[model samples]
Target: MTIKNIIISGASRGIGFELAKQLCAENHQVIALSRNITPLQALALPNLHPICFDLQDQDAYKGLVAYLTEKQLSVDVLINNAGKIINKPFEDLGLQDWQEVYATNVFGVAELTKSVLPFMNKEGHVVTVSSMGGVQGSMKFPGLAAYSSSKGAVITLTELLAEEYKETGPAFNVLALGAVQTEMLNEAFPGYKAPVSAAEMASYIKHFAMTGQQFYNGKLLQVANTTP
Candidate 1:
């Protein structure tokens, strides 16, 4: 496979870190973005460029767009993996909690995507990481109403974007991922053991990230063997 220029959000750790490692191993140029890029810098891959920025910061997202534009770089794949979770029951959750979750999961993804659209290759692929909880009829957990709702919003946003960009622009899709072993998961559910590992999820994400534009668009992929 020809090397592709890929941009991955939340690349400091977890699934994002693995995605950067595996994609760089495949000789792809990876632009890794995260609030803390120190971990990414430690990777020391020649093809990996680490950008430190909070996805919730609109100015930072715009700065990234400026950098890409100045370099005349077009991305083959864009992975929206940065997300925030507020694990509080529906009754206990406040407006701030909801805003915090949506800020990172939905608003950030949308703003960055809008800025990056011009830098996407004609056949570029856009993959947004969502949660299985966001998928209707899937398993629901207590204290995840805010998190689930944010992810669900992104899923809808992604599909709408896919339709808007269907004939021209890039292809867009959503991965309503199942329980994956990651820091976020542990934070959301203490002592919970997930069937899928972060590395495994990253591998699957790479597969779809690389092939989504070529095969499917506007589809919500359920990346779980069984409902959690």
Candidate 2:
């Protein structure tokens, strides 16, 4: 059997859900998390272990750790895919909006990661799903201040963690995902188009992850609108 244990957050739908479903199909045991506790009937993968909790909830981590420890789960991969974006003009973006965005996308992720790291075995991989907007100048649409900034912070956090963990830290990368068909985008840009489908992106991410290329560490895997 393969080293199948992985934890995927933000997995109720979109790229997170697709990645979890596809990984399970490839015989990986996926521990999926989202605000909603139930698994989507459409993603009928037997290897999926579902957990429902709002990442912002401090109480959730203890229960999660207790459950995993009871099961004697040692993780091979830690996927920080859970995040929220509020695409609004900086001026128009209220403090509450930014707080909400950071609470889920940044602070919560860091908390979960910190809580889970001890359970990750050596050589385990950590993948953080980020955004191209976090990269260099992009003349993209408006109302992206909160989302883009938070993603940039996530990338920085990934790099810092990579350095801190050194050999013990799993090879980590912040994948800067291009436009993908997701509910988040649909809500923000109603008539907007995406460069790829979530399933396709998931496939590419899984493949990129398996390569285990050292050069990719502490760098951005720029998966464009193309094959990625």
Candidate 3:
């Protein structure tokens, strides 16, 4: 198999961490980005490169581009898996709360994708991770007004990007995930048991991120067995 240079965000734990570990085990060069990369560094895998990255930081994007340029790495897959959520009732949600969520979920995804496009291989894939709550008429909860709406925005963004870049080469797709037993899930829904584990979901995402572009572009696949 041809080794691919893959970039994944939110790699400190959960699905992102599993993706980094699994991809490196397969001999792929993995660039794992997260605010706290200590967990990733502990793995000490030669093929795994952990970088301290904050999705909300503008300076971090520049640093990432510089690092990629310095390493002369051409990205084959870019996974926008980093997300932020504030679980507050709509009436209690302040402007800052909404901004914080969108900064990471929507704006960060857009900025990071744009920053990495020049380094992407013509046949590369960009996968943005969304939530089932974002899909219109799926299932609405009380405390996800900001989080869910931001996710919906990215779905449209991905479609627009795929259309614009269709003639260029690289492809864009978004995945609306179902409930997974992740730290984020535990935080959002305390004491709730999810049918899927983080590693299990990560495995599916790993396979999809590497090969899904061959058959899908500008498509939103709802990877959920249960609703939130």
TM per model?
A: 0.97, 0.92, 0.98
- Residue runs of model 1 more than 4 Å from their true location after superposition: none
TM-score of 3: 0.98
lDDT of 3 at 2: 85
Summarize candidate 1's per-residue lDDT along 108-205 as a digit string, tens digits. 89988887888886689999999898998888889999999889999999989999988886999999998899998899889999999999999999
State in Å the error of residue 80, model 3: 0.4
Candidate with best lDDT: 3
How many residue pairs clash in model 2?
1
Candidate 2: tens digits of C-alpha lDDT, residues 84-171: 8776777898889989999987897788888788888666778888888887665455788888888889989988988888777677
The candidate 1 region of ten consecutive residues with least summed lDDT is: 53-62
What is the alpha-carbon lDDT of model 2 when measured against the actual structure?
0.81
Best by TM-score: 3
Per-residue accuracy of model 3 over 1-228 as CA lDDT, tens digit each: 889999999999889999999999999999999999999999999999999999888999999999999999899999999988788889999989998999999999999999999998669999999999899889988899999999999999999999999998699999999888989988988999989999999999999998999999999999998744
Provide the overall lDDT of each model, using Cα atoms, as 2-decimal numbers: 0.90, 0.81, 0.93
Superior candidate under lDDT, 2 versus 3: 3
